[model samples]
Target: MTKTILITGSTDGIGKLAALKLAEAGHQVYVHGRNADKLTSVIAEVKAVATGAAVDNIGGFVADFSDLNAVRKMAAEVNEKLPKLDVLINNAGINTTASVMTKDGLDVRFVVNYLAPRELTNALLPLLKKSSEARIVNLSSAAQDPISYKAFVGQERLDDKDAYAQSKLALTMWSMDLADTVAADDINVIAVNPGSLLNTKMVDEAYGEYWASADKGANILTELAISDEFANDSGKYFDNDIKDGAHGDARGEFGQPHADALDKEAITELERQTQTVLQSLSA
Candidate 1:
């Protein structure tokens, strides 16, 4: 059966590839990007690969994840337009930016990589709950560091690497917390490190080189989003960098994330700090 899937940042990188693959497989795919023109183009590209009824079921949304207000607005749009959402892939992230801080006194990396996805997922919970089996696949990274609340709130400035790492750890931590919080609702939340330094724009800009093909990442994401293998997997981290010893393929493997992600104290504090920041944003 074809499922309704929404993938953020689908105009580029592994997200774009995954969106195209899913569409070709006949799933209803909604692609999102920060730029309207790019989103429109990607929607057309994705539709070109679609089979069956999925050709006419393509959708698109434009939202700059650095701004919480924009994320909320996009979520509202998704809620209003879609009846039920089966899968949500939070794939938008930034490593380097011209401006390190947003106008709202939050670090751009943390806002786009962590906070925005959290807000979007929470806002779409009602629609997700409507599906028989809803899955939230968060794009996390292997390069994780301990989260600094001060840096997250824009009080302490960090270099690009520190900010990006901490933001990913924050995302992984929340994925676990959210999974437990919504377990009764049967919505599975899984955080995944979609292979480090894949040949994508982000990696090309950050490292000037990539160790693997972006398809390696896209393949795992497509599986995590729709394959029955992950139907019962929730609150777990999938490390695609780990090769299957038996098959020698870089694919999905359940693995431990940052040590902080496993700490109950850290998760609770992150939850508290996130709520404080969100409330401040709303005010």
Candidate 2:
């Protein structure tokens, strides 16, 4: 069907591998990267494997996720690049050892890992709404710690902040609530835990155990992106490409056991806080 797919952070690691695999699967892949040279080479790799299909249909957008302004610009570009986006993968994120803040004064890790994707998705929601069937895949991890913006603004935690993990938790919860809100519109949002340890730069430079090859890391991502099973399932978490109770989906649950992600009350409060932060950024 040559479905159109856009993946952030497609320059390297799991993201780039996902782009390549989707390109090979006959999907038009829009690859993004912060680096121009990396984006250029990734485009070539995608084209080479995209034979028998309209190779030039692939597209690229470059933006450093670290900067909020750059993120806003990227958001605008995405709205203009594709008219009807079939899938949007919020895969671009980073983890830092120390606390840093964006120009808008949000923690660097929180902004890049969560705020960046959130802002981008909201900016493109109109175009996404235009699609008869649209899916938004957000990358989440087990170590992610649930957080409250109420606990962190102004007094924002940065020093050796576990803010990276907390940011991810916030993102997963946000996806959950958003999924429910948009389900009626025929759009689905799902959060994914790619895998446990992979030999990606994140692990190589930081934790030292990202041993899973990019191919393996990318599978769950593409599966959820193209799979039809998502119609019955939205706002759920999948680990290592498995449905609940499959293989490694069983990570110790967080928050309330009954509903581990984010519930209505928490989501409402978080959304209010998020709006306040976003508005503060603009003001």
Candidate 3:
């Protein structure tokens, strides 16, 4: 069965590769990017690689995720264009930037990596509910650190790594909470650490080195998006970096998430702070 999938930050890296793969498999693939030119080019590229029938199924959206209002507008556009979304992949993230502060005075990493995705997911919940089964794959990381509420709400400042790690942890925490909140609706929410340092633009800019190919991460994303193995795996975290004796191999299997991701106290605190931030944004 062909599925309708939307992948954010899909103009490049694993997100783009996954979009191409899904499009080739005849799924209705919606690719998103921050740049309009890039989005147009990627849509064309996906269409080029897609099979005969799937060629017409490729589409795209453009939004600068650093701005919450932009994310909201993009969500409205998505709701207008897509009747139902079978899978939503929150793949856009950043650890290195020319400026770390958004115009809203929040850390760029936090706003783009966590807050924007949260807002987008919530805004699209109704459409997702329309599907018999829907999957939400949040891109997490192995670099999670404890979230500082002051920093999270922009009261305090943090360096790039600190902010990025906290943002990912916050996202993972929210994923677990959201999974339970929408369990009755059969909307599966899963947090995924694609890999420690796969060969992606973000990794190259941040670490200058990679341990695996981006395809390794894209493969797991494609699986989680449609494979039946994860039908009942909501609220779970898939760590693609953990496989015994597969450390040097790029094709390692997935494992459980960091202990903090499953901690109720931490997750509750993250939810509380996230709500506070969202409310402040609205105010």
Candidate 4:
């Protein structure tokens, strides 16, 4: 079956590779990027690899996740244009940036890696509910750290790596929370640590060296997106970093996330803090 799928940050890295492979597999893929030109070129590249009618069904959207308003705009466009969405791959993330803070006064890493996806996923719930079985794949990290309340609201600052880890943990926490919310509606939300130090631009910028191929991450994402193997797996964290002990195998197994992700009190506090931040964004 050809399912409609959307992959955020598909202009490069594992996200791009996943989009191309998914398109080649004949699924309707919607690619997104922060730059319009790059997004257009990526769409053509994705189409080049697509098979059958999927070539005509390829779509593209451009949004800078660092901006909450831009995320909202893109969500509105996606809701209006795409009838329904079967899979949503929240693959956009950053470990470093020129500026630590976005124009919204939030840490750039938290905004792009966590809050943007949270907002976009919520906005697209209507379309997701239309599917027989919808899947939400959140790109988590093996670097999860305990979130600091002071830093979450932009009251205190953190180093690049700290912010990134905290943001990924935040995402994992929310993924678990959201899974319970929509389980009855047939929406399965899963968090995955694609792989540690894959050969991607983000890795090159942050670590200056990578230990595995980006395809290792892309393969797991593709499987999670469309494979019935994971049809019933929700609120679970897939740890690709555990594959083959070190260098990583494309096929990963389900594993546990940080301890905080499983804490009822922590999840409740996270939800409260998240709502407070989001409400502040509107105010």
Candidate 5:
């Protein structure tokens, strides 16, 4: 069964590698990014390495996840195009040195790293449910261990640089919580800390022109995506830092237990709060 796998931010790094790897495994992969030019190159690379895979046209989507309006439009369009999705990889995120504000009046890190993934996953829930076993993989980080307050939504009034880590923490929390909610439906929502890849362009953007790649980091992501054994593993974090198992620190102590504690009341409150905010903003 060649399932349809949708990966966000596949223009580079772990996401890009995941796309290529899944394609090689004969899955229909849809690669997404904010820039068409970047996505064009990604599609080319994926096709080159796809071996004997049963891939589709290699979808190229351009929507900056930082923008709410853009996210809504993307959800609508992607929903229409894909009636059923087997996997949804929430891999698009950013680590910026300076804080920026999106059009929706939310912190850019919160929007890109956290809110966008939440919005997109919510919008695609219906399509995901259509499939027998759906997997939603989120790209989380061990850096989210402490789950800092500075990076939390609106903690800093749009100037704090640590928002990146904070937002990642939020995403990890959400992934765990969502997993428990959808587990009964057989929809596995898991997050993995793809470890630290060496020499990737993302490092160059944040650090400098030179940084050593995590010799084994490149292959860690693919393991989670393509491994049949891990196919049913849900609500767990992959510590790319660890070779055999998920890094215990990726979600910190609050991750799994926290998600386990999310009752119907909590989920309803969260949904209401988020929907109110989104509707207010859109209005």
Candidate 6:
């Protein structure tokens, strides 16, 4: 059956590729981009590549995720447009060259990678509940670092790598907590480390090298979004780089999440800090 899917940061890279894959499969695909021009172009591109029957179902939304208010507005627009959403892929993230802090005085990485997706998912929860089954796929990474609350709040400075890693960990922690909170609703929430150093714009800008195709990430995302294998997998992390072997064994088949992601203490702290930040944003 065709599903209704929304993928954020989908103008390029794995997000865009995943959007194309879903659209081609005749799913109603909603792609988002920060730039209006680029979003329009991507919608056209997806339509161009989509099967003729699927072309009409492709759409786009524009939002600058760096701003929490913008994210809220975008969520409102999405709720207004889509009656029910089957899957939500939180794919927008950054290792920035611009200012590391947003206008609201939060770290850009934290806001875009964690806070925005958190808020968006909350805003759209009602719509998600309308579906018989719903999936939330959060993009995580292999580079997670312990989150420093001060750094997350923009009070302490951190290098790009430090900031990015911490933000991803924050996201993964929240994913687990959210999964538990919504389990009774029949919603599945999974965090994904979409293959370390895959050939994507973010990887090239940060590391200048890549180990695998962006499709490797996109493939897992597509699977998690719709495949039955993941139907019962909630509040778990899928480390795509470790297929079916030991953690940190980069050659292993990717399946389970890293050890840190499963830490009870870290997960609790992450939830506490995330709630604090969200409250501050709302206030």
State which candidate has the highest TM-score.
Answer: 4
Backbone clashes in candidate 2 total: 5
Minimum summed lDDT over a 10-residue window in model 2 is located at: 249-258
Q: Write the per-residue lDDT of candidate 4 for residues 1-283, one digit (tens) a residue.
A: 9999999989999999999999999999999999999999999999999998998999899999999999999999999999999999999988988999988789999999999999999999999999998999999999999999899999999999999999999999999999999999999999999999999999999989988899999999999999999999998999997866548554668999999999999999999999999999999
Error (Å) of candidate 3 at residue 98 is: 1.3
Pick out the ten consecutive residues of candidate 3 with the lowest summed lDDT: 244-253
For model 2, the superposed segments whose C-alpha errors exceed 4 Å read 97-99, 148-151, 159-161, 241-260
Report the lDDT tens digits of candidate 6 across residue range 1-283. Answer: 7788999999999999999998887788999999999999999988987775667788988899999889999999999998999999999999855788888788899999999999999999999999999999999988888888999877898999999998998888788889999999999999988888888898899989877878888888899899998899898888787753222324323355545577888888777877788788779
Q: What lDDT score belongs to each candidate, Candidate 1 first? A: 0.93, 0.76, 0.89, 0.94, 0.70, 0.86
Candidate 3 lDDT, tens digit per residue, 157-215?
Answer: 99889999988988888888899999999999999988778888999999899888888
Q: Using lDDT, rank the candidates from best to worst.
A: 4, 1, 3, 6, 2, 5
Runs off by more than 4 Å, candidate 1: 244-249
Better of 1 and 5 by TM-score: 1
Q: What are the per-model numbers of colliding residue pairs? A: 0, 5, 0, 0, 3, 6
Off by over 4 Å in 4: none
lDDT (tens digit, per residue) of candidate 2 on 131-181: 777889998875566674643464656443377677777888788988888
Clashing pairs in 3: none
User: Hey, what RMSD does candidate 6 come out at?
Assistant: 2.6
* Predictions: Cα RMSD each: 1.8, 3.4, 1.5, 0.8, 4.4, 2.6
Q: Which candidate is the best by lDDT?
A: 4
TM-score to native of every candidate shown? 0.97, 0.88, 0.96, 0.98, 0.81, 0.93
Off by over 4 Å in 5: 53-56, 97-99, 145-155, 158-161, 209-218, 243-276
Q: Residue 24 deviation, candidate 6, in Å? A: 0.5
